[model samples]
Target: MFVLTMYVMLLTLDDYKPTYQDRLATPGMMIRPKGNALEISYNSEDTESWDLYVQALDNFLAPYNESQQIMNNKDCTPNTYFIQEDAGEIRNNPKRSCQFNRTVLGNCSGINDRYYGYPDGQPCVLIKLNRVIGMLPGKDDQSPYVTCGAKVNYSQPLVAVKFLNVTYNADINVECKINSLAIANPTSDRDKFAGRVSFKLRINKN
Candidate 1:
């Protein structure tokens, strides 16, 4: 009887499928800048580990032409803006918890990129900024808190290594795990949901 019972239980287990609960951050969720960096961590008493993804659309372009050329000796104002329109906002609120299994990270789509297979990619976190912040490069001898080059249309999203951090699980999927992401500044008009970002890892010698 014991042997027969064990076999039946095994069959039941094989038919089981995992049920995941997705989460979203509430509006007005605070995301403040810290010195040269801004970051967030994942915490849930019950939720298990999950994956993170970003996909800067194949056609993401900065809304403005503010980025100017760097003169040989003089300093030029950064074309990038620290705050973005489509992006959420920036406020100094106590750190909040992350939503679980939620694919959409930001308030709008332009910047809330989930993921899609692409050969060329960069490491980034799919997140929603309360406000779309511009790349306010570091001035003087200070290394740019966050820096990016000329805006390239339909190009991979940029990463500001000195500016963002994800500290829940140290081991992250670069395709999903990253130390930086390029958040472009808009000098013009934009749609409601328009930006996206994605990251990729070199698997083989392809």
Candidate 2:
């Protein structure tokens, strides 16, 4: 009688970074207060209704806080993607991620006012791009920036309301597009949010 034995082996990187990515969809923009539906509705007079929105922004920004960033990440040159050729590891570390200081957000950072403008009916909506490994955004000297405008009038709309009037409720349709030469803007309805995002903002006093 003859017997045969076979051994199988799977190879992976030492740093655990994916050797190959099979993602079909491109990186897209995302907004807070996420749900099955993409709509932001809040009562201006009710603090309870908008406090959660402020909490969401605070939770989202916790990692980007100044103290947290000082420990783990290092600053890189602005307006340019930092390319490190060393797969060889740095100071016994496999990789070092760039730090995005929360202070860069300025007034929206939730540093000075913890309300994040939500209580005043001037909520700060946080929009961010999904990260893709080994992806280079923009081309030449042109950098990628997110441009948002009102969908109805096709112009920038005022996002703040000093006080809510019972007779007038602010309702605005907004669309944000990521502008970059390296990105593809899909025209099909199926791929509507490919390089852009759209949502409605409704602030009511009642």
Candidate 3:
């Protein structure tokens, strides 16, 4: 029996710094901001279904939740923001809210009367892996062969919120990296193999 091992490394924005333009160049990834929403896309060569990709994205953002239910660990389901592809619109799910302040004035006297906005007002950016292509078996005649492997890294971009009062501002960003892939079929005598590919994302704020 032949054994094939695959290793994936997890990285945050702190590991490496990359410009916004560089991160956008990565394959199978797209980041765009609409009138009031952010859209992130991920493409891959794996055969994983769309549902699986959504699950993976959910897992990736699990730690950023600030809901009371989640903090209590009471089996509370966190909120997920959804974006409609056709209309290019964003809607907050039952657990989440997509509200933002629209008015910002230069004078402090006019805006200082209201209470400070909570950090929760910021919309959570969601990432969805879309499609995968160009995957093939390895060329080696060995009984067990490695298909392919690759690594990608990028910094996370920050979404800024300017307060309508007190000139206060808050910025949030997340960095992501993906690596590792291995495919093998043991019963086949034809010596078939496959290769692996990877992608990384990075975002920054000025």
Candidate 4:
């Protein structure tokens, strides 16, 4: 009876399918540099301070290069769904995903500007969304976009704070919100960072 029961239970299980799925509707966001705290502090003129950030961005973008996508992934129709059917197994695992080249970032591609605008005081921060299984995001054909706003604006006049006598130093609190028709931005305290991320940026001249 034990041997017969074991054989019957094995037939019901699948190798590729998971028993449970993530119930969360919104995915977490991540940023580059990966500091211990939610702060990005670096000197504008100091190359050593920001070199690690540049290297981290370069390494993360290696797999998204045009050459890499051409060799590994297939080119699918733009602004359309890519439905791939699982064919019979072969010697090599062929391409099943659509091509996503780093060139899509244009100036932020890090091709022409290898430093990623770090030396020029305009630092580039890369944001990534966590992957979810069997998740079809966005309502229409339009893609998702990220929008960021700053708590303090230097362009506008401020009566509370003055920088007339201060040296070259800037500290700004910024928040980035990810917008999508399918994704939900909860207002509750527990789910405050559901589809958004906040970080402090500090740049010093010394």
Question: Against the true structure, whose lDDT is highest?
Answer: 4
Regions more than 4 Å wrong, model 4: 1-17, 86-95, 150-168, 185-188
The pairs that clash in candidate 2 are none
Candidate 4 structure quality by residue, lDDT tens digits, 84-202: 55666632334267887776654556887788666776666666666665656656765666666422111100101111222247777767666677766522258656766777777
Candidate with best TM-score: 2
Cand. 2 TM to true fold: 0.76
Error of 3 at 9 (Å): 44
Ranking by TM-score: 2, 4, 3, 1
User: 1-206, model 1: which lDDT tens digit per residue?
Assistant: 99999898776662223233222111111111111122222222222211222222322212211231111112323343233133255433332222122122132223343322111122232223232222323334332121122111211122222113323335333211212223232211232222322222221111
- Residue-wise C-alpha lDDT for candidate 3, range 120-188, written one tens digit per residue: 121222222222222221234222121211111111111121222221132323332222222332222
Per-model lDDT:
0.25, 0.61, 0.25, 0.63
Tens-digit per-residue lDDT, 1-206, candidate 2: 12222222133334446667756345566666552367777887898777777788778889988889888887877666766575464434456677777666655667876886666666666666666677677678765666675211111111221222322376677677767766665223566666667777778876
